[model samples]
Target: MMLCNESRKEAAGLTPFLTPRKTIRLATWNIRTMYEAGRTAQVAKEMKHYNTCLLGLSETRWLQTGQLRLTTGETLFTKKSKIKLNIIQCYAPTNDTDDEKKDAFYQQLPAVLDKAGKKYMAILMGDFNAKIGADNTGYNEVMGTQGLGYINENGERFADLCSLNQLVIGGSIFPHKRIHKATWRSPDHVTENQIDHICISKKFRRAWKDVKVMRGTDISSDHHLLMTAVRLHLKKFKNTTNMRTRYNVSVLKTKEVRTAFHLSLSNRFQPLQDQIENNDTNIETQWKLEARKEKKVVLNTSRTRAAKAKAQEDYTATDKEVKKNIRKDKRDHINNLAKQAEEAAGQGNLR
Candidate 1:
């Protein structure tokens, strides 16, 4: 388990991208069957331990495809990806399985691939039960020569599907030790094969960082956990809450604005000033009333400025014009400062 964890941590540093919009650590494991007691918790525990966001489970032994929310706070999507990502998790028929069953699986496979069109990024991974072998031969585009075992009938079908869909077999591209590449082992521990696999769209081939099987995971299954790190580009959403709408107090430096503000303040207080003259009402009370009215006027002016700032902020946020405006404003401020400094120097005001 310690070895498994150290290797999983090493995968994090293997990412070569300077900036990834979003990173997803995904694992595909054929857990044989999820019918055993505490099986769900055990799987969830391992998932959380490795800090994996998404997991593709196979041979779940469930009757139909459906989703479930685990008590551990992870939502299992047994079928789909909500975002533009198309994730297809499947369990292919073994070599010994009936030919009719295999034919049905291959037939349905193309239909699913068609639905997850080439326009979007798709991840097709599961216990394929096919060994592509180290001999890539004419299949160099879809797979690599680093594969294990010899090519079989199932391998031919898988390679063809990948070629047609523009999907690259991720596991075959990276060279790893045989122990790290092998996905399944026999009871005697001598027999091992790289049957399970992960494949990604060829268009986003650079996004695939690494692919290897985690043999040290504590899951009680014949198949080891196959994982891959992929960098996915995501759309960023701006948060508008708590955006500062405070008026640029420096605007008061403009003579015209200062004059306009003073005029507005006088106009607002004129009525209060007149009321004070006409009141036989207590002088102190009149003064308090005038103060309250003055405070209201100031508050109203501040609110008007705030509304204008907020409107500008909203417009810039939606249009993404904030950076441009800020650059322009910076240039203007620098020019003004330089002009003021030149004038001061002309006057010999060194201080």
Candidate 2:
């Protein structure tokens, strides 16, 4: 019920949590196949803890399963937004051929790009099951000019896509030279290939800061997790850029951004006519003072309930069959911290 109510608010684009990033924080993770068990729950837990703005997951296996809804709903600020999850998971044709299967994958690339680009900047992140322009995949300087080669990227497919879409490739090439490089398969597993990948569009290239592949984590799966962070270069209008300018004590008297608070409060309370209304203030005043404290408690309760629920539910699960969701009890703890941080920083722009 709470999720539904909150979702309604979100659908209205009334997300009160998105603090216009002083900078953008984006991350991509190839959370092992969610359906396999606890993996989904663990990934959710991590994401909520980070409160990440932009998140991408790959090898999601979302095409066959409906697990994508859970991911898109909770991550996106609004409920109405389409599930913009960017992960490609499929069975590659195993003629022991990368080119044929890759061609099919590439054929679908345009549609994938179109679908994701409709919203905020899109990232074509997932397992391509293909290698890039490396390891002399048939000598060719023209391919490099055409953006189709890497030192160890055996084939031209990886290069072609990166060049075509201007997507920044996020991953490492060290394993490509070795006999085996695989995210979905390990020595313990049957297959081996570095198929998993994460890529971002040109628009989001500014946020392309850091990309790290988490090689060892007890994820119950043999595949290494890809943890990539992209810092979006958020631009803010400088009120004053001069550092030598004299500090004004009067500036503290100035107001900060007041869009949400003003609209919600004044729109509701301003029409309350007489300062001392018809009901008589003597009785109402006493109760108002008494209730103020309680009202605060309720608001605090709600905030804590929301944030803690997010954190606990995100990380508690140890099985893939069932999501170890955050507990409702811990929400207050998180909300209190958020409130404390807001007060300490004096940045109360919550909307």
Candidate 3:
């Protein structure tokens, strides 16, 4: 059977472990197969109706593993977060499958879990084709008494894997009706079982609020949707460091740019030389005051048609002159850098 997991978060209170609390609604469903046309749309529509944020789908009958972005703007891919939650969705080998294949599947699962590391709250879920049953005797910490049906060989293996990884089976932890506990049913419409499961790290078990099967949801699949409600906030981290500036220096190879830069530099810095020698501060202040006065006159101009027209004409001319000077200044600045780089390259010291 195929499995698909979806997650949606609602803001809440503070948790003992993380920052402010958030209620994350996570679900896993065996979609069986998405090989038919419009099947993907049906799943996406159902996901939106349920208000899911992150949804992991399995047995899609697509090629190799990769991301699939739907037209509805929702993305299907493996979830990875630096803050806390790390989810791994799987469609394990069936109970009747070869023992070697099952062994290999279980062995590879641990490696995947290990890669998530201890810092993250890892969630391992999907259809394991395992029946954990209602027994919670020796495995009290790993599960609860609310599990459905009787444990099978696959269930024993699944339980052991959860135990080894210190994962708590979400389905068994919460009390619910028998109808709400079963995730899969037989094609003959007689037998029902709870094979699909959702598990979370034991360390964050408190974060898990509830888990149950949603039997009303229909997608032409034998497996029902199993959902887990977890309470833990995802804290956002931001980079505060300033970025360095970069410049292009290859234009220095042009002789026209070098000549323009030389002329601009001489015209601009020659005034600075006179200002420094004469210690002229009042002249600069006078120039600023006169410019402000011109703007004030424009603002206070009479509202007559002729006066307005004249004022607009003057403003436009001044604006054009200012823009022209700005362009010249920018071009000169670029040319100046190019000239400097050319000189440096000639000296064999381009740095």
TM-score of each: 0.60, 0.44, 0.59
Q: Which candidate is the best by TM-score?
A: 1
- Angstrom error at residue 307, model 3: 99
- Give the alpha-carbon lDDT of every model: 0.77, 0.47, 0.74
Per-residue lDDT for 154 in model 2?
A: 25
Off by over 4 Å in 2: 1-32, 37-39, 46-81, 84-101, 118-120, 133-155, 172-185, 188-194, 234-351
Q: What lDDT would candidate 1 get against the real structure?
A: 0.77
Residues 1-351, model 1: lDDT tens digits: 011222322422322322466666888999988899999888888887776766888998877554565666655555453323477888999988898998999999989888878786778999999989999888899999889989898988889889988999988999899999999999898999999999999888888889988877877899999999888654678887997778887999999999999988896777568657754344444555565555445545555778657655554443343344445556765676588668879999554
lDDT per residue (tens digit) for residues 1-351 in model 2: 001224533434433322334543444445546577666566655555554544555545554422223543443221223343443322333225676665786678666666655345556554455545334333232122212223333234655656666665654422332322335565567655555566666566556555444544445655554445554465777787667867555644545534554677774664354333533224434454455555444445555677656544433322211211223224544565577568757865443
Give lDDT: candidate 2, residue 80. Answer: 21
Which scores higher on TM-score, 2 or 3?
3
Q: Return the TM-score for candidate 2, rounded to 2 decimals.
A: 0.44
- Candidate 3: list runs displaced more than 4 Å: 1-19, 78-85, 233-351
Model 3: residue 288 alpha-carbon error in angstroms: 99
Cand. 3 TM to true fold: 0.59
Error of 3 at 313 (Å): 99
State in Å the error of residue 9, model 2: 7.0
Question: Which candidate's lDDT is highest?
Answer: 1
